[model samples]
Target: MQVEIGSNFWTYSLCEGRERKLWWESEEYSKIFLKSGRNAFKAICNYISADKRKVLFPAYHCGTESEPWYESDWEVEYYPIENNFTVDANKLKQCIIKAKPAVLVIQSYYGFDALNDECNALLQECRNKGIIIIEDITQSILSDIRHQAVDYYIASLRKFFAIPDGGVLISRQPIAIRKIAQGDNNIPLNAMQAYSLKREYFETKNKGIKEEFRAAYVVLNELISVNDNNYAMSDVSLKIWNSFDFTYIAQKRRENYRTLSEGLAKIDYLAITRTFDNDTTVPLFLPVLVKNNTLRQELQAFLAEKDIYCPIIWKKSPRIVDCPKETSAIYERILCFPIDQRYDKEDMLRIFNTVEKWNV
Candidate 1:
């Protein structure tokens, strides 16, 4: 059995052979596929032609999600997000009143509820003021608590699935933008190479294949960074995305998250970021807020040594808006455990056992 966890996807061979209906097809929203979520956000900016339109984004973000706004010359402001990973509704309301932004971008971190009761009320307040709400569902793609107040929904699919390149823009109203030219093939080509090499590494347990896989993965990321050309989702990726069984995928993620949560509770060195809500959330990852910054680094290295890799949710991105101390502290201490469809209870237990060893 493959022991590696949390990294670029290995080659995907499983396909649900029957004709399948995509989840988004049931929704009324007109959808457009893009090369990346950054490009999707850029499409929205291109659609909204206005003079000096202001936008409000959460302070705690991956940085790329909010870049299109700054690039489009929109006046940007940040609202506070509590350390508990919920929006500070009162402060956000105050920001909305003060800034009167033309657009508001909010995210439900790690597949948690995008808005609680109070935040929902704040969303209504924004709607009343004619603020265009953009919900970044990149972290919460499977989440059920989709707020209807949102004017645009955007997400990067690369985080969840094995797709080489994909991002989607969804809106209830018709979305019109200039035709996107076909993207360069290097990004997807390198991505497929990395996945194939990773699969071979697992089968043969070859150290060289693993190193080559990492190198290819690095090159893939670098290619994306330099190439910001807006492009439509490739037919190859679209077909792969359609073949998957999302129902089973979502169920597996929830189960794995519960198992990890139960196991992590007994460890004092780290704590799960928030309680899992079984009803609404299909968790993207089981995020843990490690107590000590130094311990967090140690834990990540320890896991990597055992072929279990946990990703830091966001590094200190230079583009991150200035947030309060609480948000900053959360960023410094946060780490994401793998709880995706690729693993079952045995894999989750493997992670717990390895972590228990390091807890000593």
Candidate 2:
């Protein structure tokens, strides 16, 4: 299948879905606002001080996710995540007590997975200690299982839908949210253009098209750092969010993930890290780690030649974030293959064939 940074491009049908009201801002729940995930993180960090700037996050993450903490003058530290992307509770507790960050950020990678009992215990301990918890569900936004007792929730909805730049932030407590109004329409404009360019590149493989796509990406990347963006999702983002049925999207993703997981599990070349255990968990992607780093790079390049783009999940952070050896190894070896609802079983088989034919 054709892929770009993530999955399939937005179609006109996506623009035609019905509107879904904002459900997270009610009394029983928290106040949910829309922005970029990094911007959302920045808004929360505004409430804490330099001493409390210590934010304990998972070892595996993108630089942008951690940049808010760094910019806030927080002592950003990382706790270990297992090879399977599961939290190591005992290790996490140790890091928490040692670092004593003002805030703790936990990511439910790829949406459907939940925290283990021991990890839950650690979450309780953090809460008891009065640590501000920020649960990032950018991947798990629509998962049936959710994090409880968290002070704040953050997610990048733009990843799930064809939205033009949107992130959701929820504050369980009645704290007045903060933001700076941006009159510029550059962010959404760039976002829309970026999507169009990628879809075009996918359709027409002109060599220079990628350069144009990269230019659009650079603009989108620059837009994310905006400090003062007013409340709510963009007017356009709300329309895109409203036009779709989440249940259908979630189910389709599950079907695609399960199909790929079963077929890939039989192969011996690499270790599959994520498996769809049931219907409730919707995977953002199918994660696999090649045993050899060199072969992994080669396999990725081979796929790219055929227009099957795979995400490396993330590269090692240039800033050393005190990660474990296992976590570091994982960053270097894993591949995040797109298994969203964009394609069917036959499409997955095509991906499997590419890997199967790789000369590892």
Candidate 3:
């Protein structure tokens, strides 16, 4: 079941047809702001109380994933999550009391779990202190859209769909936002380029198409690197996003995750960072932390030879790479397996069996 490189990145295939539900959350979210999820974080930061400049971020995270925290001009502060990515309420409360900061960003790692009870209580503490809560669900958009008590929610819809440009900002209550209209060649042009590269590879089975795709993305990313990231999603990207069936997307991802997670569980060397019950949490990917960076490289190479490629979660951010002793130990070791809707049970089994076979 091997295919072209970059074809199976976290989300499902956009070129194929599948069952879909025409679902929109206009009512649930006061206003649905369409943009890249990365920009949504910046927008949320802008909307928060102007007085609070310092925001607490989790220690275990990808550097770029939290770029909005920096872009919003807030003094970003770090807090620690356990090896499993769960926050301790007591420790978090202490940080809040010490920082007495304005905002708290809570992330649902891999979108397969919810905030722990202690963190839930701490969330109330933030409310009591009039602290703004920005929930980062870019990886777990469907799990919890609007927190009843949270001020704002942001998710990267592009990750879940084939659309090139998409990030959504949901206000529990409607608020005014000044942003630019998003008719950009960067996202749409780059996104469609991805589609074309994928299509060409599928049809022609040519590796040459990837260079064209890579060049497009290079230009697209360069544009993104310079923009303020306060624009809305493009019309073409939005149309592509709306055509998908939400029900099918979620169900397929859950089924694939269960098959892979169950199989991974049997191999104790690879530790699953989080686990969900009754499939309540629809995962973005099945994340596992190998024992060390050396082992990680070996495993990645081994998997690639078997036609399975897992990406390092993100290039670890230098700021948090060393301080959070735990994060430093395994940041390079984290690898994510694609468990999206595109693959079926057989696919999941192949992935699992390959990893298991590697262990043997």
1 or 3, which is superior by TM-score?
1
Q: What does candidate 1's lDDT look like per residue over 288-331, in tens digits? A: 88987888999999999999999998875576557677788878
User: Model 2 compared with the native: what TM-score?
Assistant: 0.89
Candidate order by decreasing TM-score: 1, 2, 3
List model 2 lDDT by residue over 76-102, tens digit each: 888887888888777888998788887
User: Model 2, poorest ten-residue lDDT window?
Assistant: 4-13
Tens digit of per-residue lDDT, candidate 3, span 1-360: 436322333233444444543223646556555566666676677766667689888777666557767776788877776667667777778878888778887776777554666677778778887888877777777654334457777777766666667777766577677765655756677766666766676678686775776676666666554446578777766666656776777898888888888999888778887766665577888888887788888988898786677888766676664356655555757888888876788888888888888853
Off by over 4 Å in 1: 13-23
| Cα lDDT, model 3, residue 327 | 53
Candidate 3 deviant stretches above 4 angstroms: 2-24, 32-34, 144-146
Clashing pairs in 1: none
**Backbone Cα, N, C clashes tallied per candidate:** 0, 6, 6
- Among these predictions, the greatest TM-score belongs to 1
Residue 8 lDDT in candidate 1: 82
Q: Distance from true position, residue 135, model 3, in Å?
A: 0.4
- C-alpha lDDT values of all predictions: 0.81, 0.74, 0.70
